[model samples]
Target: MLKKDKERNDAFLAIGNIANSVKSAIAPYLDGVLIYVREGLSVQSRKRGSVNPVFDCISRLAVAVGQTLSKYMEALLDPIFACDLTPKLTQALVDMGFYIPPVKPTIQERLLDMLSMVLCGEPFKPLGAPQPNTLNSVPIIPKDAKDP
Candidate 1:
């Protein structure tokens, strides 16, 4: 049996962190994860609508893939939308020292703000790739030249 919700949440997070590190490895497994997501969300749907950690893992995976998730939208969108997020969003703002706005912004605004934040980050700098040793490279001499 799956563990309690808290335990399942931690497991979901671990899988999501793996997704963040190796997204290419996640595509083939998307269907499986979607199954869990749908099931988890459905369970949450039957509750009093407390924020669920399955949603957190979904966010993590979405961030890892960006728009690549579009292809799976048909399977994902409904259960996601079926769950109410206002409480979670309000809690997030409160935690961040924000006052809830008089009117909730549309979902597009929230999504755009998230995308903007990501796009505004400092550009990624690659860890330097392997380098061939240069100090040990001897100069090649032309057959006709006395000096290398």
Candidate 2:
């Protein structure tokens, strides 16, 4: 039981770390957007309607945060694939009617991919592979050689 508890705690901690990193990266941007939206709404004095622009902006931000959190959780939980709980969590989110957006490749995707590659001991597929070195690539003359 203690071993199981430790494993669960470790998993939660790992997820928490990823969440914190993402939140720290995005919080400032979200805050700025919120302030901008609020000021715009106040200045325009737009009447509240079926589609609340302010709420929509807030909802978008919340969705972004939620998606980021889920991606991090998925990456952390991936090691224990057999015991994967991401699907369940995703389903729960859907059932709760949360605004779960489609998965789009972002910086988070790249980071998680790199992390997965490192953890799996797999070779990274660089965006552009470097040209192979050849004999001609090396300096033909010694560094000490001077102009004849």
Candidate 3:
């Protein structure tokens, strides 16, 4: 019985770890999807005259796709958390103005509050090795110099 309990615990731990990694990895992609949906809807709304039915249809289609993906991501995360904590975490996100409702919005408001601008304290600096300047670092051989 003890060994069986240990195996069950191990299974739960593995599942939790997988869920955490997936949540971290997919977050950026979901943000990109949200951005795409927002931009597509914005363009559709700016048409001068009666909107083309096809364009509007495509815009709605995009929004639905984005929403479906986002909800799936959330569903994945939900199982990782304790049942009681799930609603609390969601409410916290809502309080921070980061929650997007499941309801579809009019095209004009679809893009609103979807994109957030992040201000970095410092610019990113690449950690690559300093490249040697071939022209300056290498000594030039005279035209008459024989090959070594």
Ranking by TM-score: 1, 2, 3
TM-score of 3: 0.18
- Those runs of model 2 whose alpha carbons end farther than 4 Å from true positions after fitting are 1-25, 47-51, 66-148
- lDDT for each residue of candidate 1 in 1-148, tens digit (9 for 90 to 100): 1547566667676767887788656867877886776776675433723335666666666656554555665565556555545554334233222221221243334444444556765333335945556866867756866657
TM-score of 1: 0.52
The Cα local distance difference test for each model comes to 0.56, 0.39, 0.33
lDDT pick, better of 2 and 3? 2
**CA RMSD of each candidate after superposition:** 18.1, 17.4, 21.0
Q: Of the pair 2 and 3, which is ahead by TM-score?
A: 2
Candidate 3 lDDT, 35-130, residue by residue in tens: 432332243332322212212322232233434444533332222122222343333233222223443232113122222112343333335947
TM-scores for all predictions: 0.52, 0.24, 0.18
Winner by lDDT between candidate 3 and candidate 1: 1
